[model samples]
Target: MSTAPLLSVDWTDHVTGRRGHLVVDRLVRGVASGGLRMREGCTAEEVAGLARGMTMKEALHYDPRNRYVPLGGAKGGIDCDPRSAEAYGVLVRYLRAMRPFVERFWTTGEDLGLTQDLVDRAAAEAGLVSSIQAVYPLLDDEEEARRRLADAFAVEVDGIGLDELVGGCGVAEAALTALDRAGVPYAGTRVSVQGLGTMGGATARFLDRAGLRVVAVADVKGSIVNPDGLDVEALLAARDAHGTVDRSVLRPGDREEGPDAWLSADAEVLVPAAVSYAIDTEAQERIRARWIVEAANMPVLAEAEERLTARGVVVLPDVVVNSGTNAWWWWTLFGDVEAEADQAFAQVRGAMRALVGRILDRSEAAGVTPRAAAHALVEERLPEIAERYGWY
Candidate 1:
């Protein structure tokens, strides 16, 4: 339980003068798993925090019976807006500079401000075999595993890739599991989602399909809200690469408000599915929702989570709530599940539901937050994993 990361590196892009950081929090069987993200103002501290969260996320899903034993945690971040003309070059150079780690130690994929396809392209342009090449050595059948993961990535549901939907699927299921445990009805429940991109859009869609109303969804531009329910599908379809919804997609009854207005929407559930550290202590006060499910990593600050817990608002930690996407990648790559959509969805839902149930039960039993319960679960499981595999 040391707080120190196993390794940390900072790189300066010579062309754009932007900086990128990498932090490997831990390693299992000689490799660590995480994602690379690009955004304005991304820092080493933020990347370190995300790497630690990846550790917890991996440990939370540890199962001895499964073929996919959780790998260790790592993360990479670049301080540049992904929309900038030079961002792609920055990403390629960053990958090139980190090729040694990518080859031997760290397995990564797309995160905030990037997509898997983009990462693959950049990695290829950087003269790399694959973004996740480091994990190939552990696979039982490397060729089959690579093919399976590629097929899984090619699978799409409702116009969104399965990889993009799994995390949100897990988030929606986590929310539903919490409601079921609390004896709350899903029907007519209102959900306000922040971000209409991959996570938020998929989460809203799943919740809507499950009979909940997504009353409002905010993008980078502004909030599009309709008390009755905004059309989640339409908005999702209209979103740009950055998750911003096009204003022309607004319906007759939808009202546009400031970007931060989703915080004030009257809803039972609020999903922060966008950037890290989005909701601060002061911002948490504006939220009227009973539950804040973090579909994005580190969306709720620690102090804000403490205050929200004091106010009886349950904040589902990112470590548990947003882990399905990562888990699905390994599940496919490690042969626990096939490349098929139904199999992947079934595996993700079953695992995420069970994990969330455990977290909530431990929360009530120990009189602690779900995040605390999740951390405790990780603490218990990591030792077990290390006992079997030895910490690398």
Candidate 2:
């Protein structure tokens, strides 16, 4: 459990003095998979931890009957705000510097501050064939796999791309599974979410449709709280490319509060789908929700989770919750599922529910938190995967 990875590279952009890092946690079949993120405070240690989480995410989905064997974990991050004017140039330069790795081992897409289109654009600018082309060598039919994934990405549901919805679909399913186990009916269950971007927005939509009341949602502007659920679709439609909602779309009854107010909302479930370490010890004190579903990576700090656990609040780990996006890509490309949305959704739901159940079961049996239970599950799988493919 040392945070050591197989390889780590740090790059400094010449033009703006910005830094970037990539960490390959482990390798399976000569490749690793994760995503690239751009944010101002990114660092090598953060990327390394994320890479380790990717390893866990990949290992958790392993199955002998499935064609999509998980690859090694890896991640890339750049220190620049995505909204900054020079962000694109920094991204291209970082990709250019890491081109060798992208063409060989690390297959990445969007994460946190970056989008798929932006990553694809930057990858192309860096002279790479594709952001994921490094894994094409492992495919049965490379061309067919490429076309299928492209088609899958092209398919959109209710104006949002299919790729954006799967992760949220998985997150919502995890929450529902937790609620079901506790015998809590979804009809009156209230939920609050932080972030209105791809993961959070999609989660709100699905949870609302699943009979949960989405009472509050926080974006960069502020938290929009309405006692009776806000209009999920309208807010989603009103968001800019950066996932910030236009203030003009707010309803007369919606109360706008500070960014962190969502933490204290009167809801059974709270989702931190935006930034890492958002719920520190101070913020954790404000959360009254019975369940904190992590749709974002490392949103709950260790100390805060310890305090929350003592208070009997369940903190679902991101490795299992937000893993649907990564699993979907491999499932589609590996031909286990087609590019269609319905089949993709069914697969994600089945996989997430099973994983959540197992984690919670293990939590009770082992007398550990759900995050610890998930870590134990990954620990169980890593060896099996290693035995089959040998360590990199």
Candidate 3:
């Protein structure tokens, strides 16, 4: 069977007379949600691809066994530079004009080159809410991070930390799923997380508190390894704006290495929590862990995943593994947190469990890789949607 065709898009703002693109790559039977990124050189195809990812992500979360097709994931992008204030105003106007799409069909969330402030402004102009802020906690520049810790913790039994602070709900769920599949107890499992950005930092804090060994962590500036276990509390205390670990403050003999070294470290699990397509074909050959969890969106490429599966590595795909943030966004849109913590966590947890089960079952039955199993699952479910709609 042929692959699904890309959604047709109209790339222009009817109100501003500016060029923008609407890529509706997939359709949920009812509603579709995804991020809308604005950047220079953003193309219709890029938005479509991202939308396609969201469709698969939503599907994996909603129906892990591929029993139901993925709900529609749609992403929109405006091709413009972000350096000028004029561009921001134009973007706001563009978003306002796209309110119809936002309200009924697609939901807008933050992505690369977009900030919470920008998201809030655009959302306000369009009379919509920011998905990233809704799902993930928003620490306004004016809000004290330490002061909000209590409020964040009050929401759940577990006290809020850097995990909830940076908000890697997706990566956290992914790590939990990986541990389940490996039969490795979450407590005391050795983990090495690369890229100490929002996702990595959040996942590290959660895993560390949950009893996992965060032996090594890295960021754009540098990498650090502490096989004996690093003091997360001190690290969090000294963390810089970009969540960089201050090397000067380390308590002696804390080995520092280049970023690439983390991938080769010995551990039960490895999470590439940075950005899309970090684990490509070349990097796949260096991976030495039993389980790989993708915390970032599209962190592992298809070709690389295939290679790793050939080597007996069990990989959890980004679609399901990194969907906590997306689920949280949906929850906030449809439910309230104060009244629905159980419901929210259940939806996220259930999705993680179902996706893991489906992958394991399919892999064992066919003697195939988990990545392949997930691919097969998504493929089988895609066509059924068109059938239900009786596409012409």
Candidate 4:
């Protein structure tokens, strides 16, 4: 609650010769949950910051309306390139070493540069079970592999892949809620997405399906823009296994020269679903979107967010927009998964829309940003929770 992590652990993978950090911000009801990220230059401070955000996210999500599932916040990060051959070995050793902490204190899933398959494989090799899997026996490694294969083939595998569906679905729900609150129609609304990874790609696909024009999408390689709207399905089909859409598949007019082109594309909504600090000062200056639905954690920097707020851009914080995945996780862990994945997705979407609408309404009433309003809401409840647990 004080922004200082309750616990921090530095780990080294002796096998692959990599190092990482794990930070737990708080423990509510003796439980914490978050993702493990492996990026090129991840840092301990970054993991701590993400852990703080996760704490705030869990606080914001489990209000009185929902039967409080007391989950705390934690995050893990490794400063290694997951694309390297040594990556798998590094993960196996890391998980094996951290098995005790993971099983007892913090549970982690996939984040940037991490896939469910990797988590499953690492957990399996480490002889550890995820906290969620411990509670719900259905979420085993074989089932996870089946779900991954189903995702690859675009097949429905008995709702085993609901967790993946919720992230993008939640982003689209946030975007739609923002547009509706602003009195904008979805049919002709233009959207520009930065980062064509899992979250961004899902956001683009869902928004395009919802009748919004996806004008531009960018990845690490470069950007492509078509003012009329790009074919989301075609782009998905043409994308490489690494989630990069080849520029060669694009027409001459569709290609954008730089990676940051999506920042300046003509659109009403901009969804930054990539890495953190995407909307820096320079990006803030070039942004043309009136609304930003953050699909990634802390994609916009503090100064850039302030600038966007001053420019009257309605920036939806990631705490609200991206919390759907957490909601889905809770639902799957507690709710009956015998139901269809679409049904679960619809439930999560409705909850997200309601939460977003409430946050926006409160922000408007208080004449503050949604981020501020949501944080205030969480802060108001933290004292009672901490007092009950003696967290101070």
Highest lDDT model number: 2
lDDT of model 2 at position 194: 97
What lDDT tens digits, residue by residue, belong to model 3 across residues 215-318? Answer: 87777666788887777666766665445777777767578888777787777789887656678999888888888887766777889888888787888777
Kindly report which residue stretches of model 2 are placed more than 4 angstroms away from their true locations once superposed.
Answer: none
Off by over 4 Å in 3: 1-22, 37-46, 63-71, 77-100, 112-118, 125-170, 236-249, 335-343, 379-392
All candidates' TM-scores? 0.99, 0.99, 0.74, 0.90
Residues 1-392 of candidate 1: C-alpha lDDT, one tens digit per residue: 66999999999988879999999999999999999999999999999999999999999999889899789999999999999999999999999999999999899999999988899999999999999999999988899999999898899886789888888899999999889988999998999999877788889999999999999898888888899998888888888888887888787899999989899899999999989999999999999999999999999999999999999999999999999999999989999999888888889889989999999999999999999999999899898889999989
How well does candidate 2 score on lDDT at residue 244?
94
Rate residue 116 of model 3 by lDDT. 45
The residue ranges of model 1 lying beyond 4 angstroms of the native Cα positions read: none
Q: Which residue ranges in model 4 land beyond 4 Å of their true spot?
A: 15-17, 63-68, 131-161, 251-253, 336-339, 384-392
**How many residue pairs clash in model 1?**
0
Q: Relative to the true structure, how large is the alpha-carbon lDDT of every model?
A: 0.92, 0.94, 0.64, 0.79
* Residue 273 local lDDT, model 1: 91
* Model 4 residue 15 CA deviation in Å: 4.2
Q: Clashing residue pairs, candidate 2?
A: none
- lDDT digits (tens) for residues 194-293 of candidate 4: 8776688778888998999999998778888899888877776677635688766776557675888899999999999988888988779999899999
